[model samples]
Target: MKLSTRIALWAAAVVPVLVVLAGLLLLPLVGRDLRHQQDARLRDRAAAVLPSVRALVAADTRGRPKVEQNQQRKVVDAALDSGVRVTAEDGTVLLSVGPQPADDRAFPTAPGGPATVRDRGAAWRVLTARVSGTGANGGSGTLWVSEPGGLAGDQTAAVRRRVLLVAAVSAPVSALIGFALAERATAPLRRLSRRAAELDPAAPPTPGTGDGPGGGTNGGTEGGTDVGPGGAPFAAVRSGTAEVDELAAALALLLSRYDEQALRTAQALETARSFSSAASHELRTPLMSLRTNLDVLAAHQDLPPAERAEIVAELRDDHTRLLELLTALGTLARGDLVEVDSFGPVDLAELADAAAADARRRHPGAEITVELPPELRVFGWEPGLRIMLVNLLVNAAVHGRGGPLRADPARVTLRLAPAGPVALLTVDDAGPGVPPGERETVFHRFHRRRDSPGSGLGLTLVAQQAALHRGTVRITEPPTGTGCRVEVHLPLPDAGAPTLRLPARRDWITGGQRGDRRP
Candidate 1:
């Protein structure tokens, strides 16, 4: 049911009960007040007739019947609506007048105040006063004045009826009022619902799309107005209600998350397609070579030892190239789909040392030198950084051979140091350096020299990871030698550094886009 209707029903149910409870408390007080008023009237009447009662007592004591009868008339006249009874010292009833208890025993000789006396199912409030003559040893008697107890009860009953009538009347009236107020209060919520219903999830609002409602844009969230997240242009109504405003904000946030997830899902699907396409296209040559070599070996069992060794060596190279190609494709896909949550503080100095050590193991004949500080940290994906370091060292090992005029073994230097807010890493290789014109193209996906043994993805991976870490990578001429220097500058982790925000647009696999930092 509607909120307003619920409120109205609750008010209707509760108001009458509250009114009745109030009446229950009020009834006793009202009854007591009526009784007090009656008692006061009885006391007034007793005072008025006291003088006449004294005269009657005196006249009866002197044995004058005529005066006693006249005084009795006066006492009855003064008694008015109340009941009166006069008695002498000897217990002789001088007079009885008006409404009263028929039993004389019911009246107290000297009542402290107004007291109730009952006779034959009837009740009265009685007050007694002393009626005495002026002289000593004079005739003394009690004057009793009373009003009916039922008068207060009747008044109380009338008030009780009125209270019940009020209780019965309040139910519907309170319900109507409550419903009207509730309806008015919920108007903003209803409007919010209507707007939310009109929103199109498939085509959520984007900034600068348009100004119309749900047209994919909001003017701005200036003042207190709020715009929805994830390009949802829902401008919440500023209705001076906290609950409604908060609900609008929460809804906007939810939509934002939905939009983000949808984008990620689309990107994941695209990355998967590119991974399959690239793998098929690149692996075909190596696979064909492997098969041809294997078929030749199977067809010719009596071949020369030299010819068999050459075919076996060709098979090994093809197998290694095929493995490297698959590994590179997988790494690129990972980089494209990586989330910022996977990033953390990674020590570049330590990672570079490890990569250099691994390279030395692989190329025992090559001389590798590393100059790094004790620690150099950057906020980045640890695995990606490790991949980058290994790729850079391996690229140098394979392509960075020593010149014919220099030495037999290749020489490479890996260096790490902090430069301002960034950690600078440089790999110097004593080999034929890349040309100035082709330096930029070397980082593109699957681009390699004819004689290069490694997959072309090595430098590409280096560029991808540098961009991922909010860094830059570029090739330059070595300062002191005729070789290539690949310099990478990655941002350093700091205590007060702002949180890193990943790039929203990534299509490294499908687009074959170079991962260089855009100038």
Candidate 2:
């Protein structure tokens, strides 16, 4: 049922019951009050005749029998009008009046006190008083007065009827008023319900962020609006309640977040597609060159010694470079796909030591020195950290300029220290440093200095590794003032274990090299 109707029905049903209960409680009190008034009238009449009865008794004691009879007759005559009766204790009737049967009895043995009794079949209310005298001839006597109980009963019944009548009449009118008030109170809720019912979920309203294409003037109706892909617009229904407005605001916020995430996903997909296409195209040229060189060698079963040896060496170097380039590309792709869960606590000093040992074994001719602090802890992926350190050292060893190919030590130093909340790893070389203008470009994918024979992805991988750990890689001039120094600043883990931070934006490296003038 509607709320108003329900309230009305409840009020109608309950009010009459309350009225009836009140009437039931009040009827007895009304009856008692009416009986009190009747009793008072009876008492007043008895007092009036008492003086005359005393005079009659005094005459009887003085031996004036004739005067006593006349006085008794006078008393009896007066007492009849007041419904009273008088009697002596010695079985002598003094005066009798009103309805008193031959066997009708007075109140039993109540001395010196007023008593009451109901007369049988008469609807009368009665009161009795015992009269006492001093002389021997003057004995105790009884005086009785009565009034009709019918008047009190009728008054009580009248009061009960009046109460019932008023209750019956007022019930419907009070219920109608209550229903009207309830309807007025629920008007806002009803309007809100109707507005909600008209809303279509399939075509949700577009949110107005500002004065954009989808946004309109005047804050766009103070409600949500949905703009479909084909430029269709629909207005969301507004509930004027504050809680509903808050809910709508929260929903809009969630939708906007979803849109941003979807856009990022699309951009990442596009980047992957481009990477795959570019890698395939680039690998084709190297593969073709290698194939051509092999074909030429195969055609000559017994070639000139120097020529044959030169061709074989060229083939070996190309093959090695090709393998290195492909490996670097694969590493870069893996870094791109790395999620936050792959990170953990790593000791940068330990990683550096391992990288140094590996590099020394790989390049026995190079001079490598490692200066690491104890337990230089950072949060990052262990494999990525190792790859970054090995690449930095290798890049330095391959590119550092010293004596003519063999005499000078290719001095490389790996140092790690705790700098505030960051673990700083710096790789320094004794070689011609990156040109001031080209330092930033060297971190871009496939970027290389003109004289460097290394694949351009080495520093790019370093950049990616630093980014995954919420860190940064920068090229600073070496402390020796002669060569390049690469510093990676990684955030230290609180529990000495690696924790992943927010994913780094791809533009961290790309944005740094956008305006490069190098070919």
Return the top candidate by TM-score: 1
Candidate 1 — which residues are off by over 4 angstroms? 44-83, 90-99, 102-106, 135-138, 199-262, 291-309, 339-341, 402-410, 431-440, 477-482, 498-505, 510-512
TM-score of 2: 0.56
For model 2, how does the per-residue alpha-carbon lDDT over 451-486 read when each residue is reduced to its tens digit?
A: 677767888888777765667788878877987899
Best by lDDT: 1
Deviating ranges (above 4 Å) for candidate 2? 1-268, 294-319, 404-409, 493-500, 507-519
lDDT of each residue in 474-514, candidate 1, tens digit only:
99988985888999998887788667766544567766556
Q: Global CA lDDT of candidate 1, please?
A: 0.81
- Locate the minimum summed-lDDT window of 10 residues in model 2: 211-220
RMSD of 1: 5.4
